[model samples]
Target chain A: MRLELGKIFIKDVQFSDETRVENGILYINKEELLKEVSGDERLRSIDVELAKPGEEVRIIPVKDVIEPRVKVEGKGGIFPGFISKVDTVGSGRTHVLKGAAVVTTGKIVGFQEGIIDMTGEGAKYTPFSKTNNIVLVCEPVDNLPQHEHEEAVRMVGFKAACYLGRAGKNVEPDEIKVYETLPLLEQVNMYPHLPKVVYVYMLQSQGLLHDTYVYGVDAKKIIPTFIYPTEVFDGAIVSGNCVSACDKNPTYVHMNNPIIEDLYERHGKDINFIGCIITNENVYLADKERSSNYTAKLVEFLGADAAIISEEGFGNPDADLVMNCNKIEEKGIKTVLVTDEYAGRDGASQSLADSTPKGDAVVTAGNANELILLPPMKKIIGHVEAADIIAGGFAGSLREDGSIEAEIQVITGATSEVGFGYLSAKGF
Target chain B: MKLKPVILTNNPLTKSSLENKYSVLYKKEASLLDILMFARDYVHKGHRLLTHPLMGSIKPNQTPFKSVAVSKECFNDVDLLSLEIIEESILKAEQLIKSKKTPVYTDKVLEDFSLIDFDLIKNALN
Candidate 1:
C-alpha cells in the first residue's frame, strides 16, 4: 500500500539556530510549503521531504515526545548590589533549624528553625537536610513511597550536621558529616578534602559501555563541577574530546550490577574501573513513577546530607516541590540545587532568592583562601545580589533549568585562584 | 492504526536543514513509535537485511541542554531487540500525547506495554 508522509521542524525562538521536529505529517506540496512555513524567524529554516504518491516511506521514533518538563538554566549576577553581614550568634555556638534550601531572585537562602512553612508552590525554603531543633515535613508516612522516605532521612543527616555545627560552634573539616549519594567505584587520590560522591542510578539503565556527563558545583564555593558515566551505558564511544582529558584522578562509582560491571570490563574505555560499594539494596526499576519515587526517597534517606537529584526530577512538578522545600531550616541544614536548565523568570527569581539571602558572598571556586578586603562573611552572608563571574577559557551560558552549561577552560587569574565575586543589592 | 514514518537519509540534504541539520522526536515515543513500527513492517516485508536503521534511543533524563550526535551503527541491530517492549511502552505514555493523538488511540491496553518505555532504551552491544 502507498503512504503519505511529511516531517516537522521545531526551532526554539530563544536561539537563532534551527532544530528539526519529526513525526509531523505534511498534506501540502514542498514547493508551496516553503512559502507557507518559511516566513517567521523561529520557523524560517526547515526541510520537508515527502514521499511520492506510491513510494514506501519508513517511519522512525524518538523518545520524550511528551513528558512533564522541567527547564534547568543558570545565570550569574554580573553587577554587585547591597551587601550585609551575618551575625555569628552565640560566639561559635548557635542552635539551627530543619529546612530545605531554595533560590529566590537569584539568591540561595539557608534558613534556621521554624522560619517558614510552605507547601509545593508558596514562597518558603525547602529542606536539604534534617535538623534537631525543627521538624521535617515529609510525604505522609502512610502514603509515602519507599523513595520519599529515604529522601527525608537523608535531609535529616544534613540537618543534623548543620545543627551540630551550630551547637559545637565549630565543625572540623574531617568531623563534618557529609552524605554522598553518587556511586564512586574508581577512587584516585587527589584532593584529600574532596568529599566522596556516591552515584545512585537505575539498574536497568546500567550498561557495559556508555557516555554520561555530570555537572556539579561546590555548594560552599558555588562553582561548577563535571562528571561522566561511561561504564553504566553500554559500549562507551563518546565523540567529544574533553571526555578523556577531564578523567584525571576522576571519582566514579560502580554498583553490584555484575552484568553492567562485566560489560564495562570488556567493552569499557581504557580508564581505571575501581571497586564497587553497597549503598541502598533496592534496585531502580527504570520506570518513571519508580524513578521519581527512588529519587524522592534517595533525598529523604540522606538524612540531612546534600541531596542531588539530577536525572529523574530535573523538570517535573516534583522539581518545584523538591527545590522549594524549606525543611532544611527546621533541621538547620544547608542545601543547594545543581540545575542545568531552570523554568521561567518567576521560577528563576524565586529559586535564586531562596538559595541565598542578601548578605552571603560567592567565594572563589575550588579555593580555600577566603576573600580579603570584603565585608565579613556574616555581615554580607546572604544580602548579596547576583554575581558576574568570568573564568575558564570558555564563556558560560545559562540554561532553562537554572544550571550553568559551559565548555570552561581553567585559566590563571591574578586576583583569586578560582575567582570570587559579590552579589549584593548595589550591583543590580 | 495507521502510522506516518519519516525516512532520514545519509544525504544530509534529506535530513531537515531548517532545524540543526538533524531530526528530533524520531527516536521513540507514542507518535513516533506508531509511525516507526509501521515502517519497520514495510522493511520486514522486503525481506532484506535493513543495514541502516531510521530510529535510535533517547534518554529519559535528556533535555535540550546540548545536542547529542547518535552513532549510525547503533541503528543496525534494532530488530535484535524485542518490539513488544516498544509497543507496551506506548500505553503508559498516554498522558504525554493526549492532545495530539486520535481519541480512538486511547486504548488502556497500551499501558500494559512497558518494555518500550523511553526510559528503558539502552545502547545494545549486539
Candidate 2:
C-alpha cells in the first residue's frame, strides 16, 4: 500500500461571501456550511464560528475534531463508509488542510465530551488549540435522547469536514509526503535483518456511548483483525466513543495516529514495521480474553518479534491492555504498552485498574485525574453550564465568573494514550 | 454441589497483593491442591480469598467481582466463586442463622455453606 499525503497548510480561517482556500486562508460562507450540516430535523439551530490559533475562545462539550482532507486520487473518498461510499482507501493521493480542523460542539451529549481552548493556559494541553478550527454548534430539539444528539453532532462534524475538504480539491499542495508498505511477504523480505514488529491497536468498544466504527460497522461486533498501516490515514476507523475527554482517541487522532506515523519513520531502519492488528476493549470478560488471545495469536502468526500495544480509555480497558501485553509476551514477543493514568487528583492512587508484570516496557501519557484551573475565555462557543456536570467536573466546576476549576480530564486530548500529546507523568 | 471451602475475610485485598503472593507460591511450584490448602489456611486466619477458573485467584477489591461471580453462575451454571461472594453469602447465611439483621456467623453458617459458581466443583468432580 502506498499513500501520497499532500499538505495544504491553512494559516487562518475566516467567514467570507465565498467558501474557498486562498493563500493559506480558508474562507467559509457560514450560511452555506450551516445549511449543509443542518439537514437533520433533530437540530433546532446550527451556528458556525471560526476559531483561529491565539484566539480568546473556548469550545466546551466538544464532540469531535476532524481534519479536512479530500481523496484527490484514492480508491475511496475521505471518511469512507460514513459520508463517502465504502471503498478500499489508504492508497494513491490525498490532500489535507494541515492546520485547519472542524470542531463539533453542541448540547452536551454525555458528561465525557471535551473542552478545547484556543488560547490561554488551557490551550497548552490540547492539540486542537493550535488548529484553525471551524466550530459547529448544533442545538438539538428539546427532549431529544442523548444517543440521538451524539449521532447528530458526530455526523455533522463529518459532513462539515467533507464540505471543507472540497475547498482543497483544486488547490495545489504545499508539500507531499509519501508513505508505502509492501505486502506482508515482500515487506518481510525487504527488512529481514530488522526485528519484525506489530502494533496491537485497541479500540474502545464498550457499547452505547462508547463505540468506534470501522467502515461503518460497529467495532464491538468485530473480532480481532488486521489492517494496513495506511488505512487509518484514509479514515477507515472513526471514534464515536464518549469516554473521558483526556484519553479518548477522537476522529482527528484516528486519522493521524502518531504511533503509526512514528513506526513508519522507523520502518525499514530500526524495525520491520509489520501492519497493525486492531482489537477491541470490550466490557465482557469473555470478549476481552478472546480478543487478546486472537491478537497475540495474530502477532505471533505474523512472525513479529516485538509489538507495541496502545490502549483507548481507562479503567476496565486497563484489564484488556494487560491481557494483550501478557499474552503477547507469553509468546516470547517483546511488548511495549501505551496508556494514561487515572491515579486520582493527587496522582497517588494506582494508575490503572489492572496490572501485570509483563507490562515492563510502558509509556504513560500522564494522569487524567490531575486538577487544573481554566480561566474564563473571552468567548464561549458551546453551553457554559455543561461544565458543572461533565465527567471530570464537580458541582462547582463552573464558577460565578465563568472560570472552570476541574480535573485535566475535562480538557480534550490532555492525556492521549496514542502519544498524541506532550503531557506525561513521573513519580515524584 | 460438592463441598468447596470459601475463605471469607474481614478486609478487602488488592489484586496486586494477591498476585504477588501467587507469584511467590508459583515460584515454589505449588500445585492447585497446595494452593487450595493455602487458601483454606488463609481463610482460617480470617483473610478473604476467591479462586477463579481462568483468572486464577483475584482479591476482588478493584474489579466488579460481585457482578462477575453472579453472572458466571447465572450463565455457565458453574461454581467459580470469589472471596467477595463467599463473604456476602456467609453474611446472609449468618443473618439467617442468628435470625437477625446483623450477621453473626457461628459454626451454623459453615454448616449451611453453598458455593457460588457450582461449575468449578462440577468440573473437578468430572
TM-score of predicted chain B versus true chain B for each candidate: 0.25, 0.24
Kindly list the per-residue Cα lDDT of model 1 for residues A232-304, writing each as its tens digit: 2111111100011111000111111222233234322332222211111111111222334434444344332
Backbone clashes counted, model 2:
7
Two-chain DockQ for each candidate model: 0.01, 0.03
Best TM-score among the predictions, by candidate number: 2
lDDT minimum window of 10 residues, candidate 1 chain B: B59-68
In candidate 2 the C-alpha lDDT for residue A20 amounts to: 97
DockQ of 2: 0.03
Which pairs clash in model 2? B78-B117, B78-B118, B78-B119, B79-B117, B79-B118, B79-B119, B80-B117
